[model samples]
Target: MLPTYSPYEGGHDAPELRMPTGFSRNVPERRIHSHNDYWRDVPVYTALSHGVLSIEADVWLNPKDDVLYVSHSVAALTRARTFQRLYISQLVDVLERANVHDHETTFFNYVDYYSQENEREPRRLWTSFYEGNMTPIRLLVDLKTRGNETYHAVVRELAPLRERGWLTRWNGTHVVPGPVQVLLTGNGINADVRAQVAPARDRDVFLDAPLLKLDETWLGVDGVKYGWNSSLAPMASASFSSATSWTGRRTIDPATEEAPLAALISSTQSRGFETRLWSSPRWPTHVRDRVWRTLYDLGTDWLDADDIEAAAAF
Candidate 1:
């Protein structure tokens, strides 16, 4: 028979153990993008907990201090919600915890063997649940300030992750996947991104290709023809409403809505770009589900979800 300890006794403390490498243990990575993730009560943590592989943050740069604040609008910006504090810092902490090992020698030996055979670096990866999955998670940055200045500020803010070699980068020939991939979007930012990343032999930052223009001749701000490729842009995204007229009724019209969307998805995928449709209908729970189901059926690469719980469940 076991004896119960008294409440006032001094021996009930929990045991201390080394932290595990699986920060997101058992949470399967999903292709859901946490839309406007900063709007959540706890931004990055909530999305990571839900196994969301992609997240979007709207950033406004203050020219005076060169600080980037995360918010949907300038009026809602706050000092405590800077991009560094909310996203970059938190991500760094998570990656550190996820990649660290209590037995360093064993981990290094294993990595070395794997690297020798593959002729490339081996990554433990951010998704700890999957043993050998090296897919990097996506962070979509929507710049709300002047294009060139804000783009530079965003790059500066990424120093922590960049210095740690945790950012996905494009080498002269191909892309080397890291734990996190930063994709730039939003107001008049194409020229700025092209100017900085286009000529570099190795660049960590990437651009989000326009989904609507993937099939057409995409011209940059400098009037140079730019092609959509995995090296330059990994994903193409657009609004759901812009692609379809269906209001999420019981059934979708085949020719007008379904066919066109499928074609777009096919086109984007053919160009080796992951497809994403944002600003999907959220009204009438069933309608949202219908649209999501249709997207999945059409082979859409990533689902833009405002409600992480519901999207995860689906």
Candidate 2:
């Protein structure tokens, strides 16, 4: 008879038995936005792990050092924590593994051996990178530095992803969706550069519109009237306070928020742009939960939050 095995006793400790299965990556993407994501314990991975695909990185272009440093403030900037190291390179690695094809094999054969036509042909069809969670991960690059140079610097740094066809780009006439969508936020996009790129069918970066003022034909402060569309600003945002003052007190009065919030959401969505609201009520955990649920009910595209885990769970 086999040795009497005690239920509590560990049998032959096998490696598979000793190590538990890896965590699931199939967690559905939540509308949660990870604000100032670099501050998190592990940057991009932290939010991704929490099923929050929208992550913001406040990048300051250090003119002297010529480095795009990711941080909330200049005082926190460090060379070791640059955006390339933390986000871009890591994304390349993740997508490379996810591609599931031999990079060594040329995708297009210059000369087809099987065909007597001697014409070029696809040696192996290009495979689109499959995001395990099947969510379009968005990277909100908040420009801490204002200038054409700084904007261009951020664009240059995106080459690793851009070259790999992983970045969402605008073709001459329309926008082509990619695995990662990059939105440039903080201080409007350079006007001159926008004008130049506006005609071009394809571009790697996008502008973040001020949703609160999107409907305004006349500028409140500058008194400048301008027409805007989806190509110019594919994503729009506003402060939570702009919509309502329900600061985590009593339940949000539908009477107060229903009309205004509905109009804002509808108008923004009509223009083919997603909407986001930052500076949401955070105090009183219950109020935060209520706000999160309210935003969900409103069908807000991206629910912005500093507490990524909590928001993702919500």
Candidate 3:
């Protein structure tokens, strides 16, 4: 599910099942800003078991490493928890030995949520994932800051990789089947990304302009469980929604789905964009076919399902 605020509702987010059938979240490495010491060992079991479209992470490139490592927080960077941890599984060797995945998407929301800064020069996380048998997942890289520095750094790292067909643009535009795409999202995008959208689109990676700003009626519970001060005076009506931060802290009450869904639908209709909402599993458990049918009912263009929650429950 495209990181929904808690209090879950209905649609496709079925963490109980995972992927194509069940729903799970696949954000960027930067946001995964938790702890590499621990997360580095185990892969996202839920993503593997359930099959999320993409995974998330907050990447910080060590100015020195030229060697990319994964650490949600800069403080956590160490020899033990390197981003190339993917190679620990020999997925890279096997590939030197082959593959990238289906249309499955992975969103990399960069920039530390708490501390907004790009972590120096880091290797491409996508390249690391590919080395780990990640099957060329469609990756959307959100530039936390230094949109140019981060984007260019990432793209620079991707040149050879893309040439090998291991990576492409995220937005699902790169015509190459099983190609991974890179996209930019995040507050940093507001100031500079607009100009590059056309060029990025040309390269196969699309840029997501500022989304809704979080506020009172707008509401956002993801970060800090009910973030306030949605719209900034300087940037009034941009797409970035501050009131509705997207994280795991809280969720918008399903009763509040109408407006959000309407806005989402509008985004889809206008930009031909796609998003994922983790549907609350309670409804499906209570009525069986509650979620899937809801998507069918709503005419969701695309979604990830599992075990026919809606079909079996209802």
Per model, how many backbone clashes are there?
Answer: 0, 2, 75
Provide the lDDT at 161 for model 2.
89
Q: Which ten residues in a row have the lowest lDDT in candidate 3?
A: 28-37
Best by TM-score: 1
CA lDDT of 144 in candidate 2? Answer: 81
User: Mind giving the per-residue lDDT tens digits that candidate 2 earns over 1-314?
Assistant: 45754344465553333311123235566777888687775777777677777888888888887789888887887778998988898777656554534333334342253234423321211122222233467888888887767777888999998887788788667666666888888843445445444454568787787887665432222334444567867788878888666675666667776667877888789888889989888878888888878877888898889888788767
What is the Cα-based TM-score of model 2?
0.78
lDDT of 3 at 303: 38
lDDT of 2: 0.70
Tell me the spans in candidate 1 whose CA falls farther than 4 Å from its real position.
1-19, 103-108, 122-128, 215-224
Model 3, span 6-81: residue lDDT tens: 4445435634223321111332211111111234344333333233334433455556655445455567667655
User: Regarding TM-score, does 2 or 3 come out ahead?
Assistant: 2
Every model's TM-score: 0.88, 0.78, 0.45
In terms of lDDT, the poorest run of 10 residues in model 2 is 121-130
lDDT of each: 0.80, 0.70, 0.36
Give me the overall lDDT of model 3.
Answer: 0.36
Worst 10 residues of 1 by lDDT: 11-20
True-structure lDDT of candidate 1: 0.80
